[model samples]
Target: MFRRFALAGFAAALLFLSTTPVVAAGLDAASINDAAAPPTRLPDRQQLSPSIARLEILLDRAHFSPGEIDGKFGENAQKALAAFAEANGLSFDKAVTADLWTRLVAASEGAAVVTYTIVDADVKGPFLNKVPVKMESMKDLPALNYTSPREALAEKFHMSEALLQALNPGQKFDKPGDSIAVANVLDTEKPAPVARIEVDKTRQTLRTFDAAGKLIAFYPATVGSTEKPTPSGTLKVTAINKNPTYHYNPKYKFKGVKSKRPFTIKPGPNNPVGVVWINLSGEGYGIHGTGNPGKISKAESHGCVRLTNWDALRVAAGVAKGTPVAFVESSR
Candidate 1:
């Protein structure tokens, strides 16, 4: 299922919004025709199509992450908008009506993407030569860090390594102080302090809402599995740790570990938990980032909600202490 939501009117809305571009976030203020204003002269579906990339960026700006922006109007984009609509209390009325268009333009306030010069710090890595696949091997590493400059750069931009490569096109990200194109993404305009988090296992998504009950941001998530199911009911957020160390306890007896002694994996971007850990009241269960963003929700988690590192950071930045978290089988 694309989602648990009824798809009855979605086809019409998507068909028109799949092949054109809307006003970009980066266009000159005058040319953009009141980007800060309610949308006027609303764009046709074709115009909305090419805006997929921009839409993805804007949704991301507002913290409704569309995962990796592929510049294609597909499931992720549709889901993103649906999430946005649901958060803002808009009706999915079989089309991208003026209200929705206006809201989107208002949210997406800057250039869809822009150029970034790679800095010394960005390329400077005591980078790992390779990342091991198993916890046993990973425990022995000096740091659970990214294996290369390109990988770091991609994660920094909340992009897929592959997509980043395609954008650069034969340009090696190996050098510091080099210029590269990056999503002129939204700044750290964190949403109003998060009041709660909802993890919809059926759709494999995580959403954050404010005290006003407005959706602040949402992201694709890999919740726990049939074999290692997540805790049911509500859990409170207990703590949040950034660049967390991975502790492999022999007690858990995960498949590949030969050692009975406990060991810790040093912190880095590739750490099993990615960069941030949003610990929940459910013991050993929380929402955290993953080394494999490309596989999010495509795979089951070991009883936690897994988001991309950047997405996790985005989530972490907005939430505060003791927020309520609910794990539910959502109808949508």
Candidate 2:
């Protein structure tokens, strides 16, 4: 009976494999030698240019959530892809290959695209406007930070890196600053609410809530590691400092920094924390920026909620000193 069951399972597997459609066209040695051979178009119905806008949408649909889908794929996109791949049992190669595309399509099948229209009330000012606009290509944006080459284009446009990958579906972004067009626009008025963070040591996630207690953002975060765990208690924001200078004291070396190291670093993105610093009520512990935004939710920190510079900035602007910050093991 066991042998029969095994045979049946093998047969089913073979049938499934056989039913899987083969999409790649045959390319012979002659085709490889023929310089006149036309380029192979991607499987998608539309011909998407290698722009950041397209990449941003793709990454967004894949549930990587590259923050804002600005266009230029960057460090955030790469981080999102790595996390997505890990969760999906795929290799974190950063390259969006045919296999990755298939998985993304499967993952984004039920995903919803919320539309937003620009309103007079939504427009902050000349410098900041929540306008309903569209772009032909993500290449129109300026250069992006290239920590992860796979998602460099997305970063350049100040867009969400994960969304770019999802929009492109099966296409790979090997080159830096690749351009792509984004067809969708913010056609309605549905603004995303402010982010409220709830640190949970047990689940290892920073749950973001809105004014109504509705969970809007959820990010995996590296609280204090096992050896130097994060302090368990409630804390509140004391102050928000932008472009903060890090006073690196050797005595407080969580990562074994020698005493001879520099005492302080100038305010810049490369500082110990990235660009923003939110001082918590705790003397030494606080939610601050990180030099390595990609490792925000992955690696352990000294004893703080380390967020990406952009993420930290958003959180800082959304909350105040009196805003309640709860540090709990779990929601329950």
Candidate 3:
């Protein structure tokens, strides 16, 4: 019976994302318009689509704190669910599924999940214009290899992917032969401060909090390895460097090749450290960007908290000298 329910749930999710012809192929204006046209009233907890409800339950079990699980897909619920999905090698899309629920349950039971929260609103942009741009031709655009075209745009604009998606939700990127609208890009306003960081060692999660204890954002992180346990204590952001030239010292015990070349990689997403570096006042410890976001919170770092390049940049921008950071073992 459980298996049958799971399979049925998965099929329903497919209909939600694929069969919904009105939904666009990428983050585009049409999609956004459709999504914004009439806010579909979310079902009650008992009436929620099985997959979504299962996802909520699993997230709650994993300690993701998906607000009130009345089964309504609210902003808080979506954010929490996305964070959990991202941690488990799933896309951040708010859609839920049986597989996702199963994996989440397994992680909770077996101790494999992690969570992070945004404590501050630091690095602002690439700001997104309320209005989307009309792409005359995607024929000239690059292949859609990554997650969303907006994500690709974020790369082009040198801004956080999360910010791009947040500004333009449910938009489609493909317009076939017609021109598709793209949102106007804006400059980052000002850097703000992150208030708190909640690190769950058991679930291998890290969360950030604001002074008011509100969750601004969240991300998965790679902590220290068993050989080199991550240092515990309250750390503070001492400095932030953008497009930093990494100083690879052979003595530092890095996993990759030891180069005498002092390999100074340029900034951008492909950089070894991604784009931003939050230097912590706690000596050699700091939170920095990573070339591999998919492996975040799942892999081990040298000792510092490792986050996705986009996430790290935002965190760095929000943080400053004396931003307090705490690392704790996760109960979930």
Candidate 4:
């Protein structure tokens, strides 16, 4: 399930490690293409762009997740289609056609878009005005909640907030009495337990595969920066924590911190680690969720890899304590 929005965000870049250079100079502008999922050579979307989005949603529901389902037949969708085709005993490089359409429709259970009621709970509660950039400054907040109700709802339905807003221009997302339409794509299929996770720092993407080396899930990520580069070797997932409180040690000397002492950031979906923290064996490194889904693969992190909260949860849920997590420079 997607995360719900709430107030009380404790901004954190994790306790820093200045042995490396200070690397969190967030970029000013980011493009959609900045978020590259693993690409495939397979032919895509013979139809219109919306048709491509629908096909992506179908692929997602049928257990092959294509990153964010943004309705673009970009790299991620092509990869997902190729994976699905190969799994179903069809040629992986074939173009989109009637045969593929028949298979997808048969595998899919519902429409790609459906009407959803925005309940009071989904829009309820105190919301955070904004998440703080420095964890050291937060002394009173209880938890790191979502920055807005729109974010909470978007996570609930697995769509970007901007895309959700575009789908319903006049609806008030923050209020209780709004019925809206949203992407019906949900990753409910239990994937084969993930055998390994590859973190491509160059491409800023994470790919998960089963024992047979079939790609099952893909996500755009913001890996470590130049100053705080992620470990350049293989690691393993040490632990998984839901609603993990972030403890920031002041010794690392992260940028913009006036405090000289350590602090603890409360746990919530908007926390630096977002909803779930998949801890890696590498020292102070792992894959976790992020507050800004849009900036994923575009922004730089202190040293950890970051994905959207929902995507992280989807991948984390399927992994185990000993799952291999490899950090490598982009192969593509």
Candidate 5:
């Protein structure tokens, strides 16, 4: 029997908005949208700055995904800015120059952050109380759903859950019709067709190109680890599965999974492979999403190319069977 769970005890019936207006915090929508690029470059250490958060949203809208919008100038955000700079033929290092900032702001759409009203679909979820940490224990669950409405909304806006809460302090995510500030990072139109894909193990990033060799999209990725390295050379895409059942093979001996026997995990947002799977021609290797978006390029993967769930979905939508995917040792 499948156990259904309500998200954060939210009522099935959608609630009307209260008369109270949502107060803006230090990292509020107004601040984010009104923020300007710092005259100097971002600090080397990760810090919560409204400007960085705004920059991240703009990068996300432009398809140079900065893993998750966590209001920090981390390595993932750095990589994304670097990729964006390179695509625009601008010189960049660990810092964002004035020219780069101007180009990014010009390329992006309206505001970086906008007010979004919560809806019934956003709150009404048969969510999971908790996802198991071990792979063996996950097979028995009916489905891997989002743990809370906050998580769903965060992923939907391409923002981190922490950022979501930080932006809306003291507000419970359980009510529909309640206003919340979210990243204006919606990509309504379908992506252009991808001609080729490049997975850089050294850089821990993925890039897609058009038929004319124009860079289409760039994403920070967690490639294979030392335990099981990803394949080299070019490979063709075999298949793309939007909702994939994760079949665990015993031979690979993935650490922390004590099960010697084969098993299959049900598909949902919190599944081992997340929501999408782009299978590669190389045996036992593929590009897929991850349950943990925050640990994207910061963590290690078994042997597959791991992208954020949204990034994986974007890639899956743009690519087709026989799309050339090349794995490189280094971009240098």
Candidate 6:
């Protein structure tokens, strides 16, 4: 139960925003790290707020991912915050209360943003000039690398490409030895082993549990669409494939794919299955990563559950071959 691919349409928009000083000037590390509790009502969708960005980074650090940290208090961010609040016994009524903020900050380690020195690896690319929009065209490419250094660094730190540019105005990501402020979300330590996983279709979320049934991690996810609904009941992990090559089955008859023949897509971050694919017992169904990190939870998948590349990697690292994966149809 996986989509052949979902084209992320935000690249051009992010590239355009990178050049706009006004947009990038609106926030910085100081603003983000020192951000106060947000107002009762969230910021407008169009408005980028440092407070929300801080909130997102904190939530991410706490193992409750907000998907892409775009500095916007959108549904994904709200969902993460609400989940965090519920876990901490704080009542969230669509507001960032002082109690919730205090709890989040206390639970999270390190500042929301920190200085990162760009290394040669960060700037060096075998970078793709452009990724193909169509899945069929993508199969021929050598590798599905990030389109730019900004994209690479942004993904590494679990921040949006636009947010990375916004934090370091006028700083081109092309050079090594340059320093920039980025989200302090590098998970250096290994995650706790997961005994079980729950995919809440209604909530568009994935939650992992420890052997003692304690929540280990939570992530916003893109569930299946009406066209290809996710499987019900429970499944078990069959395998964990890192940097997996995407194999397409013509039998799926995925929309927009004209080829009646099966094909294979090369492995990379932007591959259809992304950095990691946690195979499930159900055929073609597993929780995996997405090329379009920004569109996660906001868009629908073909059938399989989709999380951010980083989150997927973390989840893959945490779960064993036989971990139980339950797909809950509703909140109950």
**Which prediction has the highest TM-score against the true structure?**
6
lDDT of 5 by residue, 238-330 (tens): 999988999999998998888989999999999989999999999889999988999998889989999989999999999999999999987
Candidate 5 off by > 4 Å: 1-25, 39-46
Q: Residue 87 in candidate 2 has what lDDT? A: 59
Q: What TM-score would candidate 1 get against the native?
A: 0.79
Give each model's clash number: 11, 40, 32, 2, 0, 3
Model 2 misses residue 243 by how many Å?
A: 1.0
Query: CA lDDT, every prediction?
Result: 0.69, 0.48, 0.48, 0.67, 0.84, 0.84
The deviation in Å at residue 122 for candidate 3 is 24
| Model 4: lDDT of residue 291 | 77
lDDT of 2: 0.48
Q: For residues 236-306, what per-residue lDDT tens digits would candidate 6 score against the true structure?
A: 99999999999999888787888988999999999988999999999899889987899998888879999
Q: lDDT per residue, candidate 4, 93-155, as tens digits?
A: 536755666787678565566666677888775678888876665545887777677878887
Task: Rank candidates by TM-score, best first.
Answer: 6, 5, 1, 4, 3, 2
Model 6 scores worst on lDDT over the 10 consecutive residues at: 1-10
List candidate 2 stretches off by more than 4 Å.
1-196, 260-262
Worst ten in a row by lDDT for model 5: 1-10
- The TM-scores of all predictions, comma-separated, are 0.79, 0.49, 0.49, 0.74, 0.91, 0.92
RMSD of 5: 7.6
All-Cα superposition RMSD per candidate:
9.2, 16.5, 14.6, 10.9, 7.6, 6.5
What is the per-residue lDDT of model 1 for residues 210-297, given as tens digits with 9 covering 90 to 100? 8888677789888888767898899998888998998776776555567889988888878889899999987678899988876777
